[model samples]
Target: MVVIHDGYFTDVEGCIKENWFQIDSLLAKQILCRFSLPFNKLAIFTLYNNCVHLSAICILINLFHIYILTRKALRTTSPIYILLTAIAMIDIVSLSYDIHTEIVEVYKVFKVCYSKETDYTIILLNNIMEFIRNYSRRCSTWLSFSIALIRTLIVKYPLNPKLEILSKPKIAFYIIPTILILSAPIHFMDIYKYQIVFYDENFKCTQFPSYTTLYYGSILSDYYEQDDVWLWKLNRTIDAVISKFIPCILFPIVTYLLVIEIRLADERRKKLNQSSIAEKDSKNTTKLVLFLTLPFFLGELPIGLILLTKPIDKLREAIGFSLFTEGIEKFFSVVLSATTATHMIVCVFMSSQYRESALSFIRCGVKFKSQNS
Candidate 1:
């Protein structure tokens, strides 16, 4: 059992001292005497392996996007096409730091660095992680908002009546600004609220500070005063509404309405001029919306309910939905994967034009390499 001090776990200094001494005496010597060089080499290999794996995947995805946009043969200049690129760009940017950070942390794991500079790196990395988190959350909100608004417009107003007027990037003009404005509040989430914990083999970060730990530490005890507690609860409540329920409800309703409008439009078009292609397009759109959005709704519901209600039953339900039985760390990862998968699937599947372009690009590159040989 340990106490708390300032904003950190109490006795952390002593704990770190004991751990470092143990590392130096037991693990360090053993590692050095038997397999130090080989171990270091292996760590480097693993680091490179992970970096290359992530970087390569990102490159491939981006290359595919580029191919689709550039290819004249499959030029699809639709609002949905633009949305796909926007989502891909977000993923690429988010992944750029994420992959590198993972690689760096993995490398550090083999040879731990606990100096002031290490702390700085940790701070920088933590901030980047936070930025990525907020950025991703904002992206999700915006994506849903955009799609919902688009569907709303298409359902509310047919394009044929005002075809020329609606073609001027209606979605981008409105949704972009709304998302930017709505996401502004997230920047206020400071690093000071939570203390980082190094436990077991890896450091497990927690959003909620242990009350016992906080009470022991003056800084944390002061930080977690009644006012702060209320604020935190309020913020959590706001997040539940803004990030989860609103988007979940709005997206489905808008999508349903849009589907109905599409069906109606198809019927009208068929009566006017029988075209199987238009019918196929409507079916594809319906499928695309359902496939992309259902996972998000499923993933968020349990977590959102738990957070909002905080009932034991609800919390247990959320835990059941969690991917791993390993506790909070695994829970966070599960939620993240589930949420991001929605965006990823939508971006990839929505634009068939992009896929064709990407495949052709890959083939050409392989051909060029073969010819060089």
Candidate 2:
């Protein structure tokens, strides 16, 4: 019995020495760990693999849709056509990055092997992906806002020649480039905000310290106490407000005004007993804008809110609770990806122009195949 007690005591001492008693730390440490074989591994692999495949498929379909739309735009010289094409192009690029990131992650899990050189590549890709993801997201939201704002102007000032000029394809050429240029630099700041660190024999990219120094004559202070930390947090808050929340708020307001304008136009047309071609075209464009923006608002709002409210300390604290939180965060990421793919699918189904373009492309392919046969 004495020997048994001695052995048990030694085991407990060893566990304490190894820090296994720190359950919170253990859970936190496991947050980003690759899932082990059979169940967990299979589940994550399936989830990522499916997302990659679906996103790729949607991207290809959208590319075809863009080609058709561009050809139509050349003929019509319509600003709405130009904007739709630009949106499709952005979606394709964003989806490509999504697929690439998923592929790299899945490879990391299955192989469990990476070198220092590979670490640099991983870090670079991660930074690029982060920049593109944020840039594309903001661009999409802004483009939607532009559409709503322009439509509102058209409805409210139907006789304003200046507003009419702004709706031309020539103006879209300038507006699209301006939006791209504006949305890019803010997101590019992410390149400096993160760094790659070695963990579990693999390099992982994570946020760098917001401030390298605290102050003179002080024991190294906690990160949260740093002025730079709050500044960075505030920057993120402002970004979320501008890129996500404002657009969300404005979308509904502008859309409401659009509905009223449409009703007013319909009433005016009834009294005149003649609907001008421009009025019909404006109504159709409004329908397209509604279809495009509504899904984006619904699908992206949860993600934006999550980003705004996520606890900054969760990643730093090696705690068991963090595992649950991290898991929830990852689940949200999957939902976001699913929603992104759904947006393309929704476009194909809801937008008559996109659907017709896709169908026409398919028919052309069938005809070419028959001719070859």
Candidate 3:
């Protein structure tokens, strides 16, 4: 969502990331009335200032993550690496989209692009970025879940030939596409929910006197028919169930199983007084997946809770007046951007192969710099 001139358009629409909510309808009217200059600054800082730096850092980190995973040692270690490589790529795209929208908002906020007429293409372009951001963010969420599930299965059944398909790195070639295909349907609803409209007659911007007319994109209730409203609500519900709540639930369960299995494996190693490289690799993989899922699980839990209340009629009524959803939703953008940022650190600490390669990568950079100097 882009914020320009005294307008707040769009919100954290889904559980994993944002979809689209507009400023001209539903909660927007109340927000516009209650939140003025100070609040707008707060909203601005909350969404833009926080996300820009964090998102940029994460985008760079995710690039490194994708590159580091390409090392033959790390790549051959587990299929989780392949899935992780896919997740890192998505994270980079998602975080870059986050920064792009924030930059647009910053430009629109301080700069006067005065227009007596509506600019449909501007917000439409923002809508396209929102579409890609939400889609890639969802892909990251599902792939993280896939990693948890796959790693659990591989760790638990270390000798099952039935699970052999999952152990192959090439399976990610299949899994990534499957996730992209399956996670796509909900994002198609973006174009229908919001559109750019000219608010010339009723435009009110007391804070900014540079322009008399305001052309902003918002989710207008008037744009929806009765059936369309129901469809929109249904889509949100389905998205919450699939995107938000399910992973929040599954991550913990799979994490618990991984911990139990790894603990048991460690005890077995101690008893045997012997540890094979394969066994060591298995434990390390468990640790990597364990650390990997933590951020997603913690990040998604509160979002899932907010989504749980969205369907309740009483809470829905209160949401119009309450800034609870607004603050949390904007904060979610930063959180989503920072999700993959932690993975690199986790890898350096937990996964031996990644640690070695990461050191090697750093050394190569230093050596190159020395030669250039």
Candidate 4:
């Protein structure tokens, strides 16, 4: 979601065309130097053009699949199914947040007439949006990681009765809530780091004396001055280290270990005269984990690195590098959104039961439509 903020100022037509959208002279100078044009606008336009409709359709499809998956998981009391259902639910929430924020942002960019009160409300909403976006995104990540961990346990400890208890829907319900509650505190840092500022009769919402502003002047300068600036920076560094960097490193390691365990189990099964139903289920779960994890790793790792680096003006000074970084950010936003949106499709392909349920649901719909006609 922070990635999407790069394009938030693209609608400043004055800044783009005539450099007339004055905030504070210092702020304007920092903005003009750091925030480039056409690329941001193009990224925003391209997102609306391509991702908006696709995301809407995917959300619908995801809801349908989530319904089927939830029913199946509850009926079967399958941990893997429950985890998949949880992932689907989180994806839906994340996608909804993205859609809502994008719509609000587009309105701010093109339609809303800025008033002091209106700007205040928008800024508040933006902060709330960032909170939800980060919260849901982290929840989604942890849920996926949980899936991989559960599957690894299943593969490695097939005979453990205690581990089998994890498959129960009641246990899954507990796990989901526990994950959500634990991850909530990490994102409180985001709320502290961002706030609304009013300048030159216009309200702007941004990080306190953002990297660009700090680059242009000392921390004590008129526009860049904020008593809590160091605290905010400290919080951001801690957040990046704990939330982004740790997970980025740990997820891949866990995934790799899961893959190895799954493979070893497969080989053991081959030596047997017959594989148990649980063994078969483990294989399917492994496949699903691979599908989900690949997209998450590819999409999130670079975004994490970008956030961790927090490119300063010196780094951004390279010719075309700023635009390039913006493009990378936008590109991964699409990837992450697409990955979340198409999750049901991944499940449908990876699990025969899901595919069959989907087909049956479609048939029922068709029959109902024909009867109505």
Question: Best-fitting candidate, measured by TM-score?
Answer: 3
Q: Is candidate 1 or candidate 4 better by TM-score?
A: 4
Alpha-carbon error at 26 in model 3, in Å? Answer: 26
> Once superposed on the true structure, which residue ranges of model 3 sit more than 4 Å away at CA?
1-44, 47-49, 106-111, 114-118, 201-213, 221-228, 270-272, 319-321, 365-373
How far off is residue 19 in model 1, in Å? 31
lDDT of 1 by residue, 1-373 (tens): 2332332212334333444123446554344324322332333334332444544465455646644654563333445445545555665555565566666667555645344345446655656675675566557556655755554565457555664433344445455566666776754553344444433223332444233222111122234335636555565566666767677678777778877777787778778986675456545655555565666665565556545653223332332212112122224334444344344445446545445555567587353221100
RMSD (Cα, Å) of model 4 = 9.2
Q: Write the per-residue lDDT of candidate 4 for residues 247-348, one digit (tens) a residue.
A: 778777878888888777777768886677656655776787778777777777776766655434433443234554565667676678777756676777
Better TM-score candidate (2, 3): 3
TM-score of 2: 0.70
Give me the displacement of residue 99 in model 1, in angstroms: 3.0
lDDT over C-alpha atoms for residue 7 of model 3: 28
- Of candidate 2, the 10-residue stretch with the lowest lDDT total is 212-221
> What are the TM-scores, per candidate, against the unseen true structure?
0.61, 0.70, 0.78, 0.73
Best-first order by TM-score:
3, 4, 2, 1
State in Å the error of residue 244, model 1. Answer: 1.5
Tens digits of per-residue lDDT for model 2 on 20-121? 224545553343232322222233445544567777777876776577777662326567667777777787777777788778767666655445566567
Better of 1 and 2 by TM-score: 2
**Which residue pairs in model 1 clash with each other?**
3-10, 4-10, 4-217
Error of 2 at 184 (Å): 3.1
